[model samples]
Target: MNIQQILKISADKLRQKNIPSTALDAEVLLLEALSKCADEIPPAPFLKGGVLANDAPRNDNKRLDKNWLYINNNYELNKKEEELFNNFINQRLKHKPVAYILNRKEFYGYDFYVDENVLIPRPETELIVEEVLKILNNDRREQACLFPTIIDIGTGSGCIIISILNELAKNKKDKIIHNAYANDISSEAISTAKINAKKYNLNKKIKFIRNDFEKFLNKKSIYNSNEIIITANLPYVKNDAYKTLSEDIRKYEPKIALTAGRDGLVCIESLVKSVLKIKKKYKQKIYIFIEADPDQMSRIMAISREKLANVNLEIIKDLSGKKRIIKLLYCHPELVEGWKAR
Candidate 1:
């Protein structure tokens, strides 16, 4: 069958199975299949005047853009492409996520390798990267010569830390010295994160630690910088809420990366406590950006207030206007008043 016909059939099958984003899933899977068949078939012809047929820019050289399918609606898929597309559709029908099937997810405009071992990077999580960049930029403006240490707690796919480093590397004027570390408890998750880090040529830029966050934080020797920035997208889904999540998420994504505990704040709470200890131990300027469910923002603020004195907290809303990131600024008591005014 041709591209158009096969896409319709696959989308219909997914729709029948009550899958969300049926059409998108179908197109993405077909594009991936087409990529695998690239060795057999030559690249699709460009449209008139050197413009892309679908008008969408190609991000991956290995994968064809979805618009290519529209441009080549009548193009016939060979046996290998047809077989691969069908296999992917079957996985989708079983409630698997498209990211898991593709083994890749895009975060902060960079694609990272992913799998069942790691949580698929979410769009909202990009807010953490944005916040971190803002902090780094602020340091540059103030001419803070001190090197900052960035720690990404529970770095499932190392998306947060890697993206931050990639952005920093892009700005030639960025003179801030910094260190980056990705810490996760799961060895498999660390392995997946390493693959992505190496993909972006960031293997040496980030240190991957397969250890619990609390334990890693206790090792004072690792944190040698006075300006420390922490970014975490830890599991904040309550146990009960986890059960109600869509089959695509619950069945395919790693559960340990999703659900926290009864209150959904187990991981965040522990992180806060550890930060307080670090704060007490070092008279340093610390900034933390944490992504959590909107409903849990107030509780997180309250926890921060109770544990750390003179810490300033801010809530950053996502595109949907949901409180998605909690920014915590804690520093030496003498500097609190000055930082709070900003």
Candidate 2:
């Protein structure tokens, strides 16, 4: 059958199975399957329409561009292409995420490898990276410090920390003498993050630690007046709420990275408590950015009010206009007067 016919059949099958975004998922999976087959069979028939397996094209420019797969969807699929496409369709019927089937996901203009071990990077997470850039740029203009430290808590897939490093390296105004840390309790998550760091040639720039928040804080590290930024996208989905999530998420994605406690705020609360201890011991102000469920904002703030005595808190809304991120400026109580919550 032709390419268009195959896509239609696969999409219909997915729709019958109640898969969300069936059309888009069908297209992505088809392209991925075609790309994978192109490697084993050189100058493959389906590849003539410009779908090379490798990331970059050959130096001689003989290899067809990868984008051709999406551009020329009307091209015919050979017998081998039909076999591979069917297998992918079967996987999707089982509620597997397309990113996992493809082993790749794009975030903040950078692509990273993903699997069942880590949570697939979402678009909303980009906001955390954007806010970090704005804060760092502002600090460069106002402060005389030459080095800044970045710590990413529960850094699954290492998307947040690595994206930040790539952006910071581009700024010519500032010398990039930054110490970055990414810590995760799951060793599988840490391993996946290390793979992504190596993919971007950022292995040395980031220190990937396989430990939780409390353990990381217990280490013998100095926290002086130099700028420190903490970014956490820890688990915030409640246990009961996790059960209500779609099969595509609950079945395929790691549960350790999704559900918190009964209230969905246990991991976040623990991280905040650790930050309070760090602040008291070091006596240096630190800026924190976190991603949480929009509905949990009031309870999170209440936790901060009781545990974090001196903090300036602001809640940021996601693109959907829902409360998504919590920005906290942890410093002395007296300094809180000058800054207004945004």
lDDT of each: 0.87, 0.81
Q: For model 2, what is the alpha-carbon lDDT of residue 64?
A: 36
Q: What is the lDDT of residue 259 in candidate 2?
A: 91
lDDT of 1 by residue, 116-219 (tens): 99999999999999888876766454454667888899999999988888898897433464678899999999999999989988898788889999999998
Number of the predicted model whose TM-score against the real structure is largest: 1
TM-score of every prediction relative to native: 0.91, 0.87
Q: What are the candidates' C-alpha RMSDs?
A: 3.4, 4.6
lDDT of 1 at 326: 95
lDDT of 2 by residue, 183-235 (tens): 99999999999999999888987888888777886665735435578999999
Model 2 score (lDDT): 0.81
Weakest 10 consecutive residues of candidate 1 by summed lDDT: 52-61
